[model samples]
Target chain A: MANITTNPESAGGSLTARALREGFYAGIVSLGLFVLFVGLETTQNIRNELVLRQRWGLLLTFVLVAAVGRFLTVAYVRPWVAARKAAAVARVRDESAPDSFFKRNFNAIAIVALILYPILAMLIFGVQGSLKWVDNFGIQILIYVMLAWGLNIVVGLAGLLDLGYVAFYAVGAYSYALLSQHFGFSFWVLLPLAGILAAFWGMILGFPVLRLKGDYLAIVTLAFGEIIRLVLINWTEVTRGTFGISSIPKASVFGIWSFDVGAANNFAKVFGLPMSSAYYKVFLFYLILALALLTAYVTIRLRRMPVGRAWEALREDEIACRSLGINTVTTKLTAFSIGAMFGGFAGSFFAVRQGFVSPESFVFLESAIILSIVVLGGMGSLVGIAVAAAVMVGGTELLREMQFLKQIFGPDFTPELYRMLIFGLAMVIVMVWKPRGFVGSREPTAFLKERKAVSGSFTKEGHG
Target chain B: MAPETNTATDTMTNDPILKVEHLSMRFGGLMAINDLSFEAQRGEITALIGPNGAGKTTVFNCVTGFYKPTMGMISMRQASGKTFLLERMPDFEITRDAKVARTFQNIRLFTGLTVLENLLVAQHNTLMKASGYTILGLLGLPAYKNASAASIELAKHWLEKAHLIERADDPAGDLPYGAQRRLEIARAMCTGPEFLCLDEPAAGLNPRESLALNELLTGIRRDTGTSILLIEHDMSVVMEISDHVVVLEYGQKISDGTPDHVKNDPKVIAAYLGVEDEEVEEVIEEIEEIEEGGKH
Candidate 1:
């Protein structure tokens, strides 16, 4: 058995090595292109006026570089890495060693990388301006990550298809918005209140669907989400209809400084620095970061609890879950409510961050994006969701900066136009290459002792 | 181990654990169970046997709260004299509150979960109730931890009883056919039910596997004091394990008595033989005479 496994690994390793070599060459070519772009931008006067006007050489060169880069990365780099890992695993097995050399080395490197990430980012962009990366990429994605994990408890763990997940998020956001706007409640007071309100809505959704199953349940939940959005859109008196509610209150730093109070006793002023609007952004960054971490921690803990296991069982088979004396209705309700509660948390955080709330924010597209994260990442896997969110959200954000591509496709080329095309291509490639997900294993939050990677076949297909 | 000769005064002889009083179920126009009345005694292996579509499964479903009866009632009295209206409760509450656990004709283990996890999930309600799902419990509260540990212990205990401790970590779906059936019963037992209803528990088992299953059911009845309501087609299993038997034909009770008595009944013979009812008595009498002549 061991020999059979090792044979495939060794074969895979050689393939990976070849891919790595190709990737190295592609990197060199891209670097040369970058240098050419810098030269063209700086030394325009040195070239003939006709040469600059035609620009055929630059356009041709840019296209060639992009084509070569893509070819090398896909045809060689990806396969090479996969083969190398496979071969390394085979070698470790042949030697009968517990921990491979790479595993031990990678752990140490990861620890160092994590420790230096924030410090290095601060140095590169300045602490105040670094808020963009921390907020947009970090906190924004983390909120979705939390929402995905919560949804996993329902759709992934309990096998309950809940399309109305955004309803709970809307509930939480509205809960916080209404309480603060009407009664002058603080962020601290409304955060839990939002969760409770969302949970209440979750139960409301759960009750009517107690007898529903399969596609029927899905349609009902989908309708429920649309209903919530329509209500927000049409209820002009309270929600202000499609105009939306603006100038919403932002979360403060323990009431240390009013955001509108100018630089006089502001948070940055206490540190003897000029208070920029970026100060508030940084504060919001850390606030959502903490909330996201708390969400992950709570979800992890819940999986080990009886209710968590019940949810998994329910997911596997409702008949068996009931036969085991689990109240299926209650278990389903708990999963729906708990998942909704987290959605609420993320929704409320979104409202505060943007300082606005609108019906458009809770559209079906948002639900689709979040669901894609869960499916693409591998259901019930926390780290997978985080990586998936980064890939989907960060990839789109990165597309906006591809200015070099504009020169190749002419000035008419807009990167955003190809965003959806690239996104769809990436999804198809991932699905074909790794159908069970990038991280295809059931990583239960809690276990008896040491955790091991259980195989991925147990979960729904197209998810981990 | 004389098989407990005190059966006359055992729980089986006292107030019946499950009493199906004139229960009838209809699907549109066809009556699945028609005026079927019988009592399953506690600590007794009672078998419900007939040919296919004899309403055995329907009766079991109605009793377990899976199907609502169109007419009649299923009254179950526990040792504490707590009478449960089985038809009134949902399937979940039937298992949780009434302590009525059942196995399906097609074994339905949580195939994705490990063998032990299947049993642990069966004990879900107990652990969840004990923990109260508070924030303290979510924070790994001591009581919650203890309950979780106890659940694992119970799971391990049942896994050992089912002779599946070695395969505890394997997915339930990976088990061989017979082991999967045994695991299903063990999972049901983990729920700590007062009565265990098995739908075709020995449907696909070989002769030896079926005999082993009989021993397991007998042991459950003897040790746990759990009433056994089994719907089986295997005559050997029905004759070997069942202390009482109810025979159904066309959704009605044709015969009800001890296994031997029902086995010899003309009505039961006609149901299995597919003969006219008028010819049943003639065939039974001839068979009895032949038996008597052979004995002499």
Candidate 2:
């Protein structure tokens, strides 16, 4: 309801009084929230008895920080944004402006950059130093980008609230891990098999909950996720219980070249490069990037097809969809299975990357994270979800390297411990700032004369 | 006054395109419709007019396969002599296999989709086949490409017919109320239905819009030979375009005849005007006098 095109003069007139009121309210709210946690600390005495130590000074500083931040945001930042918005409104009076060269060619530029990332990192930081950037940041974020895009098919296009998408991811990972270990199958063979198995599971989940919509569907999916995790945990004869399957084989270049450090056909020896593990990390990074791009390409292509339009129509109005001769059953199932297939691909890549598959890796929290990435990125927008994954996943991974924080909070302080808190705060900020998400407008699947982006206000979130 | 005896069999002796015989729908203790029987002729607009709580929409639901009737049979015969017992078919098959499409009493366009896309969705079954269930389409085969182009052309044809070609690219939700209603009809037409059922198509339209709707419905009948069965409270629309009118009250038909015959029926006058038995004759005479004075 925050109107970006509001008159700037009125917005600027009440800055002081409104900011003071808002700041005062923020101070009170932060006081109430931080009272117990920041005001008191639990510590053990010499005799090992628990005691509550008061930290009133720390609490007061937190409250004042919150208040001042709120005050500055309201008085200065809001007015500046309002004025800028007004100027923008005047500049583009009736029609949207043409895209700049950078904006138009953004995808090409990003793809080129991603393709060169591992090589560039090795050139800049050497093999030993480039491993973390290639493996931890690049590979990890691409896996999530793929997973989020997969879930977007169900929750975004079809309007199905599937809270158990991690189940498919788990199925994919476990399929590769179990199959490779038991049958000695290569990663290349197991990847497509894993996707098929996961898609099968997706249809199985889709069948029973076909009649459900909205919150009811979400609850069932949440339970389904837990069920898959629990099955993996208890099926000791097959899944190895909580210990999981380890030493999962690494993926190769179509089973022809291996990235193994010591094999006869190893990548390093064949290419006459040094025997460093960085080559494997670089390989994994490219592999995941290719997988992510495949997901994006397939999704973009599907959006223009009839099945995809049917899914969207089913979302908009199921009754109307049926009345138009669309088979809702097939439409819903295709969305579920296709989405699960991508999750499966990402899962197999995950197993190959970590060399492990366990119930601990596929939790409800993981599903929530992937779903949030899809939502925060603007549900149906591939670019938005990818950017969201980078910011959220990469941001958390970056927290581990914040050794400079020890200078202020002492050597005992770990920024990694506050990753969840920072994540929660970021979600809140995004929701408040851009509720429709980073790229709220929808790109139409088909156009007659000209393609126009449908505004978020004109688009429905869908009922089921 | 005798419903079954007054059936509109005298006007057109040809087989009815749609026949609902002894149809009844019951929700718990309440009978929404009981022993309702009517026939809609091929390529003609048949109007179902009823007072409040007369189960007009419930009857439509049965005919459109939204709800299975509790008793009796509703059969639809296409031009090719292929007959479908609608009550036995699923809702989508009624539209797909039976070639029967419908618009809701409340507008139900895919609001998030563009005006053109709304029509494209109606052509989903055809394109889905041509796309080889998307395998061919994803590969961008020439077959799929041609199908896609033809579907868009069909959607454009409907858009032009509906007078919505100008706003074909805009989101359906952004259209005005009248435009949205027209878009819904355009979308339904894209399905290529032989029988189209409209539930309260003129419910909220202003007089001018209602007049425009009358033209669209009549034009569809004239050009496409698509029979229309519409439920309407707009007397002007019903009186102007409908070949036959069926009147209902308290889930029972009171009159069935040509529009003029039904309009002057004393029983219909009592049911619609809510007059007592003795006042029915007086009300009919008053209506005749008004018509005579207006004629001059």
Candidate 3:
């Protein structure tokens, strides 16, 4: 086979012209999909006279942005990829060099920031506006951070591609919701139960799918998640159908039930805190912070243990793992259950935090977002997962407040609607740029004389 | 087919660690292993040598619990005096409980893991429990830490024996081909198996590495008293390390004896040289003279 190497100079073309030519082709495709399809409906306004007027300005701007973005990407990304490939041989050897400062200290800095979340929230957003920032960015991102860490065990360490992780999340949420609503179980009481229930479901899903691997395993897991969702939606008597179970109850602080309080009898009032939703939001933030920390601590410890090594071994080569006397069945099941257990903790926390449990929240998109967080964060990396969760989840939330874009794109522009579009673009760009995400370097769980962090170059995306 | 009364020529016959009785493995209509019986004696090296597709790997797979034979039984006697039907158990149970550890024909080290971690993973069952199923280990409990330290010591010991101690912290994939092969054997040995099954351990090794492998195998037998069943195409390795040689031709055992006895066997030479029954004696004489000269 002849290897084809095309140099820009050999091609005898200007970079801008080449990029513009490529961009023009990509722009045509984008224009067809965005302007002719998705954007057309969004821009149309059927006013009082029943006239279908098109917002041509927004459509044109969208096309131009897409074209320009593609042009710059074509111009820069290609050479960058070529350079990365050129350094590939040396990179693997250089990977085991002493831990780079950023990868080593990212956790300490992140933890300090996380520890001071409440104080930081107070300073940045203030008492009145802190609730939104804390609840949406802090709690929401932490919940996902916990979820990604959980999924990391299965997809990252075990090399099991699970597309139905949300099933376990739903199991946790519903376990808390149903237990709380039907029997009036308190949040503290149902917390562990939710985890146990989700783990049980994880095992149930794990058992029948032991024979599957790679893509087949992913499909089965995806189906399992959908089944859980479909069951939740159809099992109307228990789940209340699509209406969802609401007003489930807030998480109690210090095991003392918050229980039905209106100002005078409010727990927050008694504690000398403001008797507003901020109190609940702030309480939930701390609760999730504790939960997320627990997940990280456990995951870090497991990585160095025998069970953890078995998971990585199985990921490396199942046949080799089995030949070496590692019980793959138990290893895989434990990965699923343990991962689901953390997802369950996050899920029940979600229930109490939102005071609502719905099939809508446990959609496939939720699984995709969580999976993306794991992948985007660098699989098997706890700090990376946390960072990724904050970037992805917090980035989407920030988009809602991107009203400043109205100055350029017109007042009709809602940045919120382009969340998925932006997310998809960001994912592609990140994948192209870093493939391994923020902290791709991995410090060997067990080492001999020298302790060096191995870069992602030595490990596969799914491999530990 | 008769349940092991005894055969006269059973070398190292103090106790047979592994017994294959009329084990026939059929893949659809194809019989990979015919009704063949053999015993690997305790604390000795047994080599299964055969031509390509002669089902040497098939026998190894069946013994290691990777395959379930269509007919007959593979019984493995553990060091604890408990006998296990390997065909009945899962792959891991054969390695764990039955104390049978194996290496692949192609090296299958945990490429992403460090050399030490690869060996540590082979000792998974012991450390997994000591870690209290990861709970105490996660908490940095003393007992689990001690177990982890001990396992690392064991890993280091094997790494030293395999001459991989210097590269213990290196990723297994980054090692050279010969080193990876040695690492795979060391990893399997770290499992503390009573019976070691190696498929082509010296397959791609250079002359020096092959000599090192022979020493490693001999050391395992002499020091650890591990009964090894090896499948090798390298005649030098088989003749030097193996106490008993079993030759297969089209899934049937053609010759079984000490290396010299098999080297002098007419049928063995005929199978290797692809000759008629009448021409076997002539070829055997010719091959024996050459083997004698090649020995030096």
Residues B206-269, candidate 2: write the lDDT tens digits.
9999888888887788778898999999899999988889998888888998998998898898
Instruction: Quote the TM-score that chain A achieves in each candidate.
Output: 0.77, 0.84, 0.78
Ranking by TM-score: 2, 3, 1
**Docking quality band of candidate 3, CAPRI definitions:** medium
Candidate 3 lDDT, A376-442, residue by residue in tens: 9887888778778888999998999899999989999989999989999999998898898877767
* TM-score of the second chain for every model: 0.90, 0.90, 0.89
Flag the better candidate by DockQ, 2 or 3: 2
Q: What is the C-alpha lDDT of each candidate?
A: 0.79, 0.91, 0.85
Model 2: per-residue lDDT, tens digit, A233-264? 99999999999999888888887789876678
Q: How close is candidate 2 to the true structure, as a TM-score?
A: 0.88
lDDT by residue (tens digit), candidate 1, B1-296: 11365353233455588999989999999999889899987777789998899888999889988888999989988877899999998888899899999999988887777777788888877888778764568766688878878888888887777778888777777799999999999999999989999999998999988888988888788778888899999999988888889999889999998877897787788789877666877889999999999999
The candidate, 1 or 2, that scores higher on lDDT is 2
Candidate whose lDDT is highest: 2
Judged by DockQ cut-offs, the docking class of candidate 2 is: medium
